[model samples]
Target: MRKLFDDHKTDLLVFGGLILAYFLTRLPRLDLIPIFTDEAIYLRWSQIMAYDASLRYLPLVDGKPPLFMWATSIVLKLFPSLDPLLSLRLTSVGGGLFSMAGIIFTSYVFFRNKRISLLAALLYLVVPFTFFYDRFGLADSLLAAFGVWSLGLGALLVQSIRLDVALILGTAIGLGLLTKTPALFFLVTLPLQLLLFNFKTSGWKIRLVKLFLLFLLVVIISQAIFSILRLFPLFHMISQKNLEFIVTPAEFLARPFEFFFNNLKTLLTWEVGYLTAPVALTIAFAFLRGQAVKQNLILAAIFLIHLLYMSTFNKSIFPRFLLTFTPGLLVLAAVGLDQMSTRLRPSLLVLVFVLVLALPVYTDFKLLTDPPTAPIPDGDSKQYINAWPAGYGVKEIRQFLARESSQYPKVTIGTEGTFGLMPYALQLYQKDYPNVEIKDYWPLGETVPAALLEASANHPTYFIIYQRPDVPPNWKLRLVASFQQGRSNDYLRLYQILPED
Candidate 1:
């Protein structure tokens, strides 16, 4: 062990620094940002699954795979005393760190250059897209990590034909599939390995047979593990829910040209432009210079396959969907930098790195200081703060409920959403408080629910409004507390219902 450490001391030191940097950026005030609706739903599912095994298939009802929630449940069970939401976020942190390591390994495997590998890892460490999602309590980070490692191990397996690498790759692929639906993209991109394979080698026939067997082994193992999702009846819901996002074959065939053009426009302008500007520039430069053209083309093919798959299927493209290819982009960018450094001056490479990273680093700084009001586009901080039914005012509202619970025998709170962040956020916090009864009132614009009005006639009630400012004028409620984003008039209001005689 000492000898090993001594031999790779530089690598070890660099990794240590990267890990520290990751934690510094991810761990401090981990729960500072409000719990997003998805985060709340995921955490609540884990909470349910931790104690009850029968409900392990709960996330499938919402078209979600169960790996992230399962992992979260295990963490919560192990550390029962820790903050539940924070524990869930920590799982994503683990996934992010593993993803960084995977980036390094993948870069080394492909380019066989330590400088490019290290640079890829560094870029992943600091990129705002990566940094923000790594801290978030979502399955995207985990999916990205597993997808990256699977691709890396798949590359190594193709070269070495090692059983151990095959097993690891299969496991990573399985986990990725179980994490989210986008893992299918990794499988879709796997065929591009044919471009990387050498056909002119000695004993090519035998080598191809062995490679085929290994590939089959990986698919079988991954499928076997994935079959666990089918244990519940709601497993079919995954396919059903997925259909809502994607156009049917008949619909696509009828409007193929229109569908293709629209998807292409959205893909280039929004998905690719927003998340991978630097990587795209690097690819363009590589193509222009005709450097590593074959490898770059292969990478581009993989990226485009994933992009086109997402564009075709994703009705509403979210920023998080792009995470599956983030490591690939970073690796390509690293290759671009390394190649450019050889052609141009080394200082020019540094300048390119600085320019590429400037905006992302600044955005990350904003997220760290004031996440709720960060000026990041399509970020959880800005997007979910006051607009979404997240846990922005949840902590404050919970405090109010706790205080009121002591004064009254029973306190009831009605939230704007049924199962989303509002009521679920309060539900997560108020689990121990048996005196508090949390209810949901859906369809935000409608008048106060008759049930809530009837409940208010019996006792004092509170209504939490995140969707709109005004409630019915006849409801006779006073605004007790309001939580606002920094310097923003938009806020979540909690109103206390006045008792009616």
Candidate 2:
């Protein structure tokens, strides 16, 4: 071990092991799970891009970035004869790999010890939450990759202070913004930190003012070009995805302290994923005391600010949002481990490290094997359901719809759930029949179209109504397929409105 450390190859071995573990744990049964509704939405948008070379509008379904869609589209283009759920999600795998790389690169920045950096990379790579989310066809993993890379590069820029380094940092941040809007935290934080650092030294006098002006000019120019290319509409849109809910200054002023407190509660106790108490505490201790811990601490602060913003409007503040701080967390954890080893026997240090990391791994493994049963006990049940929709039978419903749609092209579907799944179902099932057409009542607003309803009644088309039976219904619609999901049953009844009625 001492020789391995001396040679600086220990970190490489650890980083390689982490990459291996990530693939082993996440790659298997990738195709086994059902295509989630959100994944389906991304796939559908990707299909749109496959047809049109230029995007017509902001493909921001509920304010999500179009990068995921672009990713899916590229995958489909590369592998035309691939499964939508399985092939498309490889992009996320790519993102996860890049993020692991970021972890190693960032750790190498502060420690300059290859072994320590590799260990940090390994810890993040094997982290169950990281692996689980990394495999999913969501935007978080990709955003996380860009965010971490930006941080690592930003650190380099601070150390080297080269114009080329600035350009690289700007590009990484631009990509991150293209991935998710919240990533702007990093873009904004860098200059603010520089200002703060200078202010602390110069007391906000002549030197600080000059530095601030130069920093502001550089930031404005970089962001102006990045925003125009990525977001296009400037303040109107945010990289084709956005925070759907707008915030006002009044809202921020209304509860300044509450925002921080609420985010604190969520960050510590969020259970949709792993929140290993022991590891968290260890990392916290390192952040408070370790060398260069101030930067990591500030990153955590920025992440907390983002969490607070999400919590204010009751936005989904999943722990995945905290992925931006992952590199910092890993570094802090390494510092803590290094401290432990220094203070105690090597054997004791090993025992404590294993225990801290192992508990979360065990719990997350259970979640991987059996998701529904492994939800955070105190949090609401729906939270887990939203996180992993493979637990839901979205795949089964898609297959069923496909097999039935072959016989009739004009079948209409109605459901209370997000209606974005139908077009994706068509994309998935279009393997055999490439020219299949599905005319479904997907957009809820379209369901109430008077002219379309009248034409449907005259033509005598089938209505697939997925609604609760207890609710009041129209007399003309007839019951057909009733699917039960857990305690709730969705009635996919066939309804034919009578011409006279």
Candidate 3:
């Protein structure tokens, strides 16, 4: 043990610093940002599943796989006293750490260079796209972690034909699939490993047969684990959700070239370019210089396969959906940086690295400190707030409800949306307050619902309007508070309904 520690002391120190940096960025004030609509749904589902075993299938009913919610339910069950939002976000933090470790491992596997490995891991830690999603309670982070580890282990299996590595890789792929549907793309790209296989040895035919059997075994294991998801009656909903976005086989056959070029343009220019500009620039440079051609080509093939599938699918796209490809991009970028460093002096290389990474690090810092007002162009920080019923006024509303509950026998509160971030946000926090009855009123343009009107006549009723500036003229109400994102109204007008004589 002493000999091992002495031999790898430098590696240990580097990893320790990386881990410290990861937590420093991820752990502080996790609950400070308002809960996103998706976060609210997932956390609420976990809360339901923690107390009731039968409700484990609840997430599947909403066309989602149950692994993340199931995992979060276990955490919540163990630490019931902890805040649900914090505990749920901690699960994502674990996934983010795993993802960082996987980037380091995958970079070393492909390039066999310590500088590239450390640089890749550092890039993963600081990038705005990874940093923002890592803090939120989402399955994409976990899926990325599993996907990267599976790619690394799969590469090793192809090189050594080892059964143990095959088993670990199979388990990683299975877990990735269970986490999200995108994991199947990793499986689709597995044949690219043939490039890494050595053909110089005699009896290459026999080796190919063995490799085929091992690959078959891995697929069987992954499918067997995936079959567990079929136990739920709503398992079919997964296919339904997939069909909602992607074209069916018949539809694709008819319009084989439909939306192909446009989707590719959008993905390359906006999604990948905006979120990972430094990495994108490095990849372009590496391709032009013709360094690590074979490995770069293999990584490119995998990324292209995943991108083609995503782009062909006809639906609205999100940046988080591109997360599974991020580790591969970072690895390519690290290789590019390492290749560039070989031609430069040590001082010049350090300066170049600092300049390359400065923008992403600054973006991450601003996202953490002042997220609502951050200048990020394409991430959850900017998009989620403007698009969804985020919990901007949730903390204040919860406090007001707590105070008002003590004054009135029962305080009825109405929110704009029913199942999204609006009601779910209050529902997660106000689960203990039975006297605080929260209801949802939908269709923003419609007049106030009769239920709210009746509630206002008897008790201290309050309406939390998220989208509209105008209120019904008949209701005697006073605006208590307003929450805005920058100058735009994210949430508005916590109204206290006045009593009528």
Steric clashes per prediction: 0, 0, 0
Predicted structure with the largest lDDT when compared to the true one: 3
Full-model lDDT, candidate 1: 0.78
Better of 1 and 3 by TM-score: 3
Quality of model 3 by C-alpha lDDT? 0.80
Per-residue lDDT of model 2, residues 364-401, tens digit only: 66556755454433342243243322224545555665
The deviation in Å at residue 32 for candidate 3 is: 2.9
RMSD of 2: 5.4
lDDT per residue as tens, model 1, 359-398: 6677678778876545445434345554544566777777
lDDT by residue (1-501, candidate 3, tens digit) is 999999999999999999999999999888877777788999999999998998888988878888888889989989988888888898899899999999899878777889989988888887877887788899999999998898888888888888898888888888888898878877778889888888999988888899889999889888877878899888999989878778888988899868788877766765554355766777665576776687788877888887887788666666677788888888888887877888789999888888888888787777777776655554454556654355676777788888888787888998877777778878887755669999887765445567777888888888887766677667667888987743355555688766655
The window of 10 residues in a row where model 2 has the poorest summed lDDT is 484-493
- Candidate 3 stretches with Cα past 4 Å from truth are 253-258, 273-275, 288-291, 379-382, 444-447, 468-476, 486-489, 498-501
Query: Order of all candidates by lDDT, from best down to worst?
Result: 3, 1, 2
Per the 3 Å backbone cut-off, how many clashing residue pairs does candidate 3 have?
0
